[model samples]
Target chain A: MTAFQPDCAVVITREDFSQDALQAEIFACGGSAGALATFVGLVRGAGPNGVIEAIEVESYPGMTESSIAAIFEEAAQRWSLLAVRVVHRVGRLEAGEQIVYVGVSSLHRREAFAACEFIMDYLKTRAPLWKKELGTGGAWWVEARDTDTEAAERWGL
Target chain B: MKIDVLFFARIREQLGVSRLTAQVEQDITLEQLQLCLAEQHASHWSEVLGGENVVRAVNQVVAENDQVLAEGDEVAFYPPVTGG
Candidate 1:
């Protein structure tokens, strides 16, 4: 890896996250990296209830930011990452709206892939954010699935 | 001792308040505090916070019920997180 981006590439905002900005930041931070990996999470239109109207995300503000930063620090320790950026949305979001983005850059494709997945996994279980689905019957807080905990466990965290 | 209690997501909806300044007896474990709140607030609060799935966090870190508490600690109760 040639150049590394700034350490804190994480973002937590209610505003619609700009993919272009994420790309630019990663590229600018990891100009020397040979590979860059990206993942974007979106709100699905269909849920167990009727079609979803929107998703409302809530987080403990100070904890949310600090926890994301702490996770990035862990990813850095585990892999030779050049740059990373994570953006998560909060508040009411329409179906198809982008909910999260995880971008990582590394010298090789494998490291980048591993780090991206690792961060996403940890973020799910470790991050202090919650989701509620709004639809016909009413709004229901999205329940955390054991599958997510299993995913996080796969990382041995 | 005094502490700050916070509720989020489903817990917030159930409790109908975002934050509360609470006074408690000394050396209470987090679980004991939950019981105290439930007795004070009644059904919905007990039903939500009492559930096994509702997670407790002490000072922003996910913690066990046995975690000890001190004055001025920030405690949060919320449903299991659902975010990517």
Candidate 2:
């Protein structure tokens, strides 16, 4: 099997985020002339309708990594992407915590922008992670939204 | 045989269990497991696993209805992911 790419995608616990990893990823892309764009998704202590008390995320270990790798590969094939990074956190998270990050570098802004968006859309609907929300009365699982499905389908995946 | 069944996010909250050991028929398929689980819960499980869109994973890999099973495998059922 091929070695995992250092700057491609990562799934780790919240405590593992480091400045060094981010910088190393940026440097590894070797895109001095390209524009780098990033998107960071934070956890909000609420669901679609109300304030969220807490959220729990779960995933299938080996499968999660493979699926994410495939998503990145697809994104790379579809756009003029130079480098892409995706980091997702699993476990208990509170409001305002970073949940996922997507970074892309390309010769032009369009590919970087589109690749970032595409990775996020694929992650939202296709990834195996699951999330539950805790609120005032009790805890509940967040329902799948049609909007998410639509966004993912827009990529034809 | 003993298989690990996992529920996550909403389904876990609803069922109130994270994982459990289940004894299912040999060569069980994902569809059969869902039906059996639904029946075991007096059909309450149907609320989560009944629909066509619900997703399943076997041994940490996303699977379809015809996926085969073996002892000691991990099976998970949950709704489509919405996380970023």
Candidate 3:
């Protein structure tokens, strides 16, 4: 595995997160990393109405980046993390759009996979991003699922 | 002491305003501030912010109800996170 650059990109943009670009970022570090694990969250088209029209993501500006950075730091402490990249989109987005991207690099596949998953789990609850599902019926703000909170709890136990 | 209050997402929609300056004669806990806000408007304000799983933040960090507030603090209220 190669070294994870000391710099971790924690961005909350309205643009797309290119997988090819993210892959290049990890490889750019050279031989210090052997495993690059990535997770891409896409907006699902299927909803109760059969098609999700759009999903609006909201974030606490000043807190969003700092909170995600803290989550990444915790992941690094729990695992052997070489580098990390997290980019989340806010505002109105159409179905099938990429919602989030989480990439982690480590020396081994196991660590890389664990770190990536760990970061994702933490992001679900710890980050200050909120979601609102919109359709013909009107807009509904998404609530945190109990299953997600449970998933975060398991990490400590 | 005066503090800035911020709202987001559903809470913002319910309250009908995004940001407001709250005047506080004295320091108060986040819980107290929430109650004060609820009293300012109709009962729905309390129903939203005081609702279950509502999250609070002070100065851009997650905070508990017991956290004390100070002058010029930026406090935000919103629902539970639903991001991945």
lDDT agreement with native, every candidate: 0.86, 0.77, 0.84
Residue pairs with clashing backbones, model 2: A45-A52, A46-A52, A141-B10
Q: Lowest-scoring 10 consecutive residues by lDDT in candidate 1 chain A?
A: A1-10
- Per-residue alpha-carbon lDDT of model 1 for A1-157, expressed as tens digits? 3233335577789998788888888888744688989999999988888889899999899888888888887787778788888999999999999999999988889989998999899878878888899987888888788888999999887
In order, what DockQ does each candidate have?
0.76, 0.67, 0.86
Of the native A-B interface contacts, what share survives in model 3? 0.89
A54-153: candidate 3 lDDT, tens digit per residue: 9999988869999888877677667777778899999888989999999988888998898888878888877888988887777787767888889888
Cα-lDDT of candidate 2: 0.77
RMSD to native for every prediction? 2.4, 3.6, 2.3
Q: Which one is best on DockQ?
A: 3
Docking quality class, candidate 2: medium
Q: What local lDDT does model 2 show for residue A119?
A: 84
Worst 10 residues of 3 chain B by lDDT: B22-31
The digit string of per-residue lDDT tens for model 2 on B17-45 reads 88888889999888888888888885567
The lowest-lDDT stretch of 10 consecutive residues in candidate 3 chain A is A1-10
DockQ of 3: 0.86
